[model samples]
Target: MSSHPTSPRPVADLFAADGRLVAIPRRPARREALLAHLAETLFASGRVYREAEVNEALKTVHEDYPALRRYLVVGGFLARTKDGAAYHRQRTAPLPGGATPSVA
Candidate 1:
């Protein structure tokens, strides 16, 4: 008998046929996973991005760039300047429910 641990849903499954995110998950765990995936794929480490650059990058994945941007910042996936003019991907980010993601 073999038992396997439950695996997280594939990040790709969250996207629609058009290659855009269908919807942002409401559940913290699921949402956090999605956000982390986005952060990894969308932005490069150690590179500062202008707000418009971030928006343009996010718009490729979802029509609701504003909400996605807010989530990324609020979820700690992306750090922003005080003026909200600059953004960059963080190496480690806090998940929802106050849990930090494990660094690999």
Candidate 2:
């Protein structure tokens, strides 16, 4: 993960006034937005990570690394091998109605 992410507009609203993560939203629309931003911060394109590596990276952001990792995969921002040993950033796929799932 890069130390900083280039500011995408939606990220402006996700951070608290003191520049800490307030919380990851629960609503699908808002959560997807936050997850997409998080995906960018945690994974680089063309990079593959072992499960431990992924968890360590996520731990830097939140205590609930497991949940964060799950959301990144389920939200379509990351992918894992069938064996579940490796993970990578994936291109965000469009939803059923042709809307891109990643908010950024």
Superposing all C-alpha atoms, what RMSD in Å does each candidate have to the true structure? 7.4, 9.9
- TM-score for each prediction? 0.80, 0.71
lDDT score for candidate 1 against the true structure = 0.87
Candidate 2, residue 78: Cα displacement in angstroms equals 0.6
- Tens digit of lDDT per residue, candidate 1, span 23-96? 98898888899999999999998789999999999999988999999999999899888888888888774547
* lDDT score at residue 40, model 1, on the 0-100 scale: 96
| lDDT (Cα, tens digit) per residue for candidate 2, span 1-104 | 77665554475576777655667777787788888888888789778889999999887766788998999988878888888888888877545777532222
lDDT for model 2 comes to 0.78
Each candidate structure's count of clashing pairs:
0, 0
* lDDT for 16 (candidate 1): 93
Clashing pairs in 1: none
Clashing pairs in 2: none
